[model samples]
Target: MKKKRSIISLCLSALFSLMLLFTSFVKPVNAAPTITLEQTFTATANPDVVGKWSEVERLRVNDTNITQELFITDNEHKTSTIVKGFGNDASPNSQLFLLHKFAGWNTATKPYPVLFVHGAGSDGDFAVDPERNGTTPGLAQSLAADGYAVFAITFAHPHGDNYIQREVLAAAIQRIKDITGKTKVDLIAHSKGNMSSRMYVSDVKKSWGTAFRNDVRRYIQLGAPNGGIDYTFRNTWAAWGIMATGAFGPVPYTYMTIYGWPTDTAYHSIYSAADGGGAYPGQAQMLARWDNVYDLDIFEQDWYTTYYGGWGYYSYSEGIDYAINQGGNLINTLKNTPVKSTVQLATLAGSENVINGVVMEDDGPSDGVVFIASATMTDPMISGGATLLEKKVLPINHVQLAYDPTALTWIKTQLSR
Candidate 1:
């Protein structure tokens, strides 16, 4: 009996030894440190600047030192001007990219952190936390309330080059990973913001830019012009209205000749520059005509001349074709570049034509600014390991995709999955 017991005990000991050996071979997950928001705030350089970040405050969260507001300097472009309505500061300092982190990072319950990329003519603050007319919370706020880590980035120029913006995005993702101890993050981009996000994921880069490091787990684009957009060129009258309201940045073509205003040489006109370099390379990158699929808005003044390149009673346009050429015709490049198959992609398009109570783009199905076809296009990302998780069209407008309650709900659902 004693010999039999000894044999059983030896077998148990060997099994225990094998378990330890197996565990040693397995890698340990880098768990997040147990840090509370209060503990994090105690380490802040400027604790007084809570809620909104001042230019000087910095915070140390989870042993990662970060500024309350971070900046990305474009080493390539030494000078850049912010669009009129986006910001007033065009100083050398303002040319740097901007980043924002909403409160409640330490208390986040989500597995992955979310990074918000604002569209053209917008910033991090306005993109995620606009002053809404109703009680519905902004998209970032909603995500934060649900205990999700939320961060946002604003480009140096509202109309900055997409190549530079994509590089900046790579930096932002690395920074978020450093702060949260998460290797991968999810990107939420809107309109033109999708250009840089797609560029990063697709590994479409400039010589100096960083290639895709496979750091993004999921990408959600809202009202993106995936197939490209020619709204301004298709409806020439819209340019006059946009410039008059001072809403969007400079249009690709100058209309001062028609409006009797002095022509601003600094305007981002395709005619004045080669490859759309003088100003607003980002805007130039998002140019593609859908005239083959849909007709130009006939009601718009000089639609024929504006689209076909001619002098009309209302305006003189070099034509949509010329604008696309001068703009680098990046849509072709983007369409050819497939997103890495590993990342999951989803897109949302707004079908509503009214934005901020103004009627726009009534000619076909559009989010006032982006057509449904352009917004929902996923053909470019299918070839690679990238999977199209879903494509949804909501009843919101282009601007509302950032803050509307319905859109926010859909975004939350996607994030949950």
Candidate 2:
């Protein structure tokens, strides 16, 4: 009995020491970074005018940072009910596609509230702000006009290397809850948008508890790089190299990113649930009936990856994909994003490590900028929530999935649950 007591005391001491170490490491983790945007009041620049030129080279080469066109006075979150300049004027030739039923023509039935999410490196202007080279017939404005009260929020800033968009989205969700007082809301997100929603749901579940989960009912992932994408290649060799580069890209201090990649949790959970046996049975049901997109008509297993680069050395699928994803074609404003080949990576390793389908030239499946399998997530089941709500196959590419007609009906069906 004396010996047992001594052993228990030693164990207690060791446990206390470990707890102290853990708290020390955790101090920095809990604090999120705050970004502040500042612009000179006298200064004025128009992104529309500045964007007319790909002066990145000139700006960097000459160090000519003085702007003739700075954003014409900081437009502080323009929130108006009937935004004349912001909303689109229905054109004589404006054609709404594939909406003859459910959404279009039938004006009596209350059209479900639709949420529009922009991807990384983009602003809400892409959906609403016309002056920011913004698109007309924005999804939020149109859906709200049809019936549903819409919510639109952009990331605090334009771009980031990680999924910082999740926090902005979380704030948006909170704002949405405050306004509607509804039990559930519908969501549609594109690119990192899909993953951002996952992070919002997963993190809220883990950090805040399950109460807020009820506020968001259905999640629709449009043209999502759900699994980390491999921009290089899908082969085994290319994957290792991409991982080496991405890992070396930035030193991570937080587990906020799904794996190290921002948009990997849902994608990883989908694949893991599909393959992992009897591992958390709850997730198996949640992630069931998700979509994995593939353009089989174009190419097969290994060979399909090559087609993304296309036949030409100067193909749009090659170098320009990253360019479009990072920043749209500076020259051609109307370049339709045609992202193909949602190739699955071979395998995953490490605890937080996952195999994302993203790849680059001469590289394999990636993590956002890399391949799918290579990307990892913190808690996958929470990332995807109760459903993946995805888009795949014919008439579906990364860009087209954003407001795809098929995804609309499906989103409504899911939310009704």
Candidate 3:
């Protein structure tokens, strides 16, 4: 009997050994990599210098350098270059700044820290904390002065891919949570910044992206083109304006025949799938026709040919519809995918169509650039699961939404709740 028992115990020990060996060979699935912290420093805004980080006041910001391993791919999403930060020419992979006001603060009245995401062609420092010597304070400064910890992220490319920007935003939220010892943070995204923030909140991401971990408390969007926009396509002259200034991304129209410039068909053409999908994936993703609802501005030169597609007197265009197709119709994707039910959502739209003195988007109610309907469109979010805290329309233009006193007051009111 003793001999038989010994043999049975030996068999059990061998089975246990096999189990251990098998488990060692299997890797964990969908595990997030540790976000590396490069360094942390206090940044002071230099008023004399006119550039990215020089806009914000020195006393209000404590900048931290953080890195996220990103799969940087071309416009087509084919081949990827593994980058430590947002890998692009605008800002290097090493200099992705996460600006916050936590270290300098003495107390906290708010439960969660506010994370600010800037719009297209803008950085966090300039977007939230612009250099304005006036009685009115920017959103970031107001929030911080009221005893709330504020944080903002600056992307490598101001007009970088939303797919990559979404991942960058997720990393920023994680870093903020870690520093504050909080479970969640409040998110405030403006203009194009809303695209990445919404993508992160809805878990609507590329296959490489991490799922939404329910880390946001209040998701507030200011002057967001939530339903998407077709400003460049609708206003063909605007495309020229962009190309002339070398600001923003590539427009659908080519300036070859009109300006005697060589044709960059790959970058300028709507059909070209060359450079990471096209010269500007971020701008392309926000393409959608509002012409069906609002009349195209007839005042502009060659509005007919620009809208329909063909050689205009000035330039050539593939039309807005073709541009939307080339853009991958990202608006439809976001419309289908809803944010998690736990997050409370809010939207603020600018009703005033006149920006500075120019009447823009006159056919429809717009904040100069974005339509009110597009900005206030939250039915999809509410229907999916998120509770709508509020949807407000302020008498301000697109640019003033971030700095106007009234808008700032409304934002403060929402954050207080």
Candidate 4:
């Protein structure tokens, strides 16, 4: 009887050991619920082009920086709205794309409001994950799920001129103020959005005096072409064609003076006194017929064109043409933009990144659109003598920089502060 009892006890111990091993091998399931949306606006697949330009092929849900652990499902929290801009000649594209928590400004539990300004060629919806596979969500939507008052801006034209875009953004800011009852909101700008935001804070806000100053608390610049990019010149013909059509608007003049390669009209390489007083060796000229331009107004009434050796000469012609045909006042409106932000500033640079479809030669470690140095605002000139509260340089490309996990984490941390 004693032998039989001991054998039974041994059998029970063996069973317990097997159960422990099985449990140890099994991975724990995530406790957080996967969020599903009633509607999703993901980027469409680019059928015409190759190399991941399309919405379907480019960004991956798993590739995003957001982790399942931090993900939360909130059907009642996500909402979108279309706010019309105050532009006198505004088109349908002037409407701002707004996405936020359904509770919106009325929610007492949410933190400060955040405004996201998208880059050129895209609107506020750019942050939204086009892949509705339940794993990927838009940046603004994610922030909303995280219990924050987040708003995004999309213009009527989608590719509207920067001046017009700026006006639209100004109106958007006022709307955000009205809805949230918050006096000031934080800004997260990408690409040309950075220039747009900077123009508003440095120049446009001055027009409003103290009210504008009080309206902005923090500004985050991601992959900003603050120092300008040579990509425009590298593809000279396309650049010329786009300029002639006034696709990018008068802001190109400003970009030329700030960051263009030193080249005179007729595409001859020259020594530029503006670019840290150094000569670019083996710099390819953009246009053979391009000549030195006179009366280039980068700043208001200040015709300084010696920068980049005379790169302005070529760009100024485009600006002049834009001013003459499309709208001269537009060119005048974008000149000599001063830089000053009353709020705290942070910069994130995507370095060593390239896109699948782009063809322009990289000047340095760039995110396939803007260089890392430009995104970081390391140039003393573009930084406007203001010190950045934080700066990060990451190895990521232009399109995904804002959505990158590293960027989102830092942004979350900063917003918490």
TM-score of every model versus the real structure? 0.77, 0.39, 0.78, 0.53
Tens-place lDDT per residue, model 1, 1-417, is 999999999999999999999999996653322222221222155333222422211212232221112112221222121222123343222224545667676568988999899887666665444652324356777888898888877665566668767766787787678778999999999888999999999988766556688899999999999999887677566566655665454444554453676554235453434432245567768889899989877777777887888776656667778777766788989899899988899899999888763447766799998989989889877776688888999998898887788888888888878
Q: Candidate 4's residue-wise lDDT over 96-191, tens digit each? A: 333332224356355568888876545454565423233565666556667777766654443334444454566567666765788878889887
Model 4 spans with C-alpha error above 4 angstroms: 1-105, 108-110, 130-135, 204-211, 236-341, 378-387
Question: What overall lDDT goes with each candidate model?
Answer: 0.69, 0.33, 0.68, 0.47
Q: Which prediction has the highest lDDT against the true structure?
A: 1
What TM value does model 3 have? 0.78
lDDT comparing candidate 4 with the true structure? 0.47
Backbone clashes, candidate 2: 50
Which whole-number lDDT from 0 to 100 does residue 201 have in model 1?
94
Total backbone collisions, model 3: 6
Rate residue 51 of model 3 by lDDT. 26
The full ranking of all candidates by lDDT, starting with the best, is 1, 3, 4, 2
Clashes of each: 3, 50, 6, 18
Error of 1 at 302 (Å): 1.6
> Using TM-score as the measure, which candidate wins?
3
Deviating ranges (above 4 Å) for candidate 1: 1-88, 91-95, 132-136, 255-277, 357-359
What is candidate 2's local distance difference test score? Answer: 0.33
